[model samples]
Structures are given as C-alpha cells and as structure tokens.
Target: MAAYPENNRTWQIIHNARKGGYAVGGFCVYNAEGVLAVIKAAERCRSPAMIQFFPWTLHFHGPAFIKYAAEVARAASVPISIHLDHCLKPSDADLALECAFDSIMVDGSMYDEEGNIKYVKSVVDRAKDKGITVEAELGRMEGGEDGLPTIDLESVFTDPDMAADFVKKTGVHFLAPSFGNVHGPYPAGGAEKHWRLDRLEKIHAALGDATPLVLHGTHPLSDEMIRVGMARGMVKVNQNRNVRNGYHEYIAENCTKVELTTLQVEAVEAYSKGVERLMVEVFDSAGKA
Candidate 1:
C-alpha cells in the first residue's frame, strides 16, 4: 500500500475507474442483506466495489456494525471498500472517522461557503491521521434520502469557477458537485430534463482528473444519463434504491410465502443480481477487479 489515499481502498477503486474510463458504484446499503449483496455481486463479477451507508447506519446499527461491515468488505476476493455517506453532523463525522470506513462523505452543505470549507478541512486533516479519504459536497443537493432530512432552503449549485479552489482549500479526496441533481426522485421532467450535464462538464473540466467526481441523486436516472456523467468525470457513482429494486420486489412478493430465513437468503441473492447487472451494464466495472 502507498501513503494516504493511495493506501485507501475507496480511493484506489475510484482512481482505477478513472484510469479505465469507467465509473465505480458506491452501493449505499442499510442492513446485513445490503452489505452481503454488494460483496456477493462484486466477487461474482470480479469488480472493485464500495459499500456505502448513511449516518443512520452508524447510529442505529452502532459502531460494531460498521466494523463488521468493513471487516467483511476488506476480506472480499476483489477490492471492496466501505464508505459512510452524507455525514451531515460534525458528531457523525467524528464517529465515522473512528470507524473502519475506507472513506467518508463529509456533508457540510448546511453551512455557508466559508464554514463548509473550514469544517471539511478540519475533518480532512483529522481523517488523514486515521488513513481515511474524505469526500464532500461542494453545494447543497436538494431533496432527502433515507437518513437525511428535507431542507426548506433553496438549492445551491456548485459553481464551476469555484470548484478547483474548493478542492484545493478543503484537501478533500473526492468532489460531489451539486449540478441540479436531487437526492430522491426527480421533478416532472425526470433526470433528463433536470440534470445539468453542461454544468457538470464544466465542474469536471475545472477539477480535471486530479480530484475524482462522484455522482449522487440517481434514484430514477437513466443508464444513458449515467454514461454521460461517467464520460464527463463521474468516477464514483453513489447508488441507493435503484440497485435494490429487484430485491425489494422479491421480498414484497415472497415475505408471506417463504420462511423468514429463506426470505433473507433469496432476497440477498436477488439484490446481488441487480447489483451485478449494474456492474456489467451501467458502471462497466465488471472484470476490472
């Protein structure tokens, strides 16, 4: 292993994607089934994967659960890293840095530009000591996810002009720029109409390949749009429910018919199948392990 991010699992996975001209999915999971699904899919496809969790997992499941997730992820046959997604609170960041996460997304969007920079920088400095790479949101992503709350504030898009400076000042490893991407479902026109690919391109051009770009708000995104992001600079694609639809369907249909134990087994298998499809289809990470 090398120093800092070079030694980190998520960094190397994302960097490998950038070099290979593809994007790696950071699968956001909530439970044991989700964790198992990511590992199984990555191993089956021989893809480098990252399992992501919201702040809820860290708190609800506790630190022990995070350790368990990280342990299994690290032991995977292929490169599988564990990440904490949308760590909004400073306390959450503190708790996450102490865990076994390979990387963490420091969500400082609640603060102003200066406050966000300082908060992220402080986390980055502390994270270095623990050998964890940091990913932070440059501007506020609208809507809410499983663990996040709804914001009444207006959406703030990341300025391409300030993109490079934000990365330079914060010392963050990955940049998740908010360019008309929402956390949950899209508005009337869907992602095709709402996504600002041109703005995304500008952000990527400003940062270049030095700081890998992360794609968020992919609930109902089309595969074509995903390709557009990867072609631009999205190296790490954070996925939540889109990849688990099959598993959710299976559970909903078979929960009453199948035994509890069998339900979980088949559910995870279904989940892995969906993830494997994305591995080969959208992300194109299959066989890159």
Candidate 2:
C-alpha cells in the first residue's frame, strides 16, 4: 500500500488544482479492495486523489473498515486523502470527522435556502475545529435521498447569488453547485441535458476564483462538457457509479476462468487499471495531481 496524504494535503491539492484550472479526481471506494485499487492507480499516475466512502458503506461494512483503509493509504507515500461522501446527516458527518477522515461533504441542499445555510454552518463549524475540509451543496440533486420529497426538475438549478451567499455565510472550503448535472447515465450523445456551462460561469463569477468548485455526477457528461467544466473553475470531479460499473463488468467477463484467489486478484487489478484509465483518459487528471 502507498502512504496517505498528510493532514490538509487533500484540500491543498484541491486548492492548487483550482488555481491551475484543472479538476482533481475524487474516486469513490466502498471497500478495502476498492481502496487498494484507487490508491494504486493514483500512485502509479503520480496524481493526488481522493478516496470517498458513502455513509451506507459503513452500515454494511462497519466503520472499522474505513479506518483500516485510511491507515493503509496513509502509510503509502502517495498523496491520497480519504473523504466521507454524501453524508446524509450531521451526525454521520461528525462520526466520520472523529474517525479522522480528511474531508466530509454535507449534502443539505434539499432543505429550504435558510435551512440549508444553517445546516452547512453547523457542519462547517464542527469540521473546521478538526481542521477537516467541508464541502457544501447549493442546489438539490434530484432523484436522490439527499433531497426532500419533491421530485420536480424545476427546483433543481442553482442560483448564483444564493450560492455565493451560502458560501459566505458558511465558510465552506468547496461548493458543489448543481448546474443541470444529474446523477445517472445519459442517453447516447444526449444533448448534455445536465450541467449548464453558463450557469457554472455565473456561479464562478459570483463566487470568484478562490473557491474550489466540484462537479458531482460527472460521469454522464461528454468529454467536451467535462473540458468545459474544467476550464470554468471546477476543481474536483466525482466518478463513483461509472467506475464501479466498469470494475464489476471487468470481473464478470474474466471470472469464469479464474480460481477464487485469482478472481479476487484479477478483479482488483482490473479495477485499478480502470481507475487509472479514468484518471488519464476520462477525467484528464493525469499529471495534474
């Protein structure tokens, strides 16, 4: 295993990437096998990357796994940071921070604007005390548990002025503003339905260049859209569902010929290669880390 990123190492990388007009990869990992693959890929590429675990992963695998994976990654000399992704509540985020995660993203954009600000400020205050980075959401992500009962797409777009105000009040290190970006895969050559570049530019204009902007649900976009996002103040790109599916497909294709240990080993290898490929090809994050 490679060494873990130093404390504050991940945020610094993210900050620098923003300055350089590139997005750093924030690959999601749900288990030890996934962690190994993400770290190995980033190490081989000589890139700084983030490994994130959803709160539900802890329910299935328990918190010990998260700690163990983080410890192993830290030991490796690679600039790898562990983050708790899409924490559903403040308590879950508090637990992750206490567990020594370098960062936690609070997804409270589902609330009313005022409620969202209050929730973010509370989390930011708690995380900053530990020197942990906090990422707050501005616009609600539709069709997810992160949102309220409303499923209307009309409620989805972010208000640039409101987003900037939320940041100013909360003092979060990064912001994930919904600019028409959605969670699932898109149709073939789809009209890039989600992620309005103009909206992103407006938000950037409002928030200014110092803030690191993260584009969630980044997988469904075309290469052109991704490049446009990078050019417009997006510093971190999250790729969870795409990479997981890629790894599973690789495993299914090659599993029939392998023994148990070999199958597990091959799956890890394939997953690691897939991640490296995403870093180099899809995300254009190679050498930016």
After superposition, which runs of candidate 1 have C-alpha atoms over 4 Å from their true positions? none
Residue-level lDDT tens digits of model 2 in 200-228:
89998998866788888665556677777
TM-scores vs. true structure, each candidate = 0.98, 0.89
lDDT of 1 at 125: 99
The lDDT values for all models are 0.92, 0.76
C-alpha RMSD between model 1 and the true structure: 1.0
Which parts of model 2 have CA positions greater than 4 angstroms off? 1-7, 145-150, 187-191
Could you tell me the TM-score of candidate 1? Answer: 0.98
Give the TM-score (vs. native) of candidate 2. Answer: 0.89
lDDT of 2: 0.76
- Candidate 1 residues 46-130, lDDT tens each? 9999999988987798999999998998889999999999988999999998899989999889899999999999999999999
* Structure candidate 1, residue pairs in collision: none
Largest TM-score belongs to which candidate? Answer: 1
- Name the lDDT value of residue 55 in candidate 1: 88
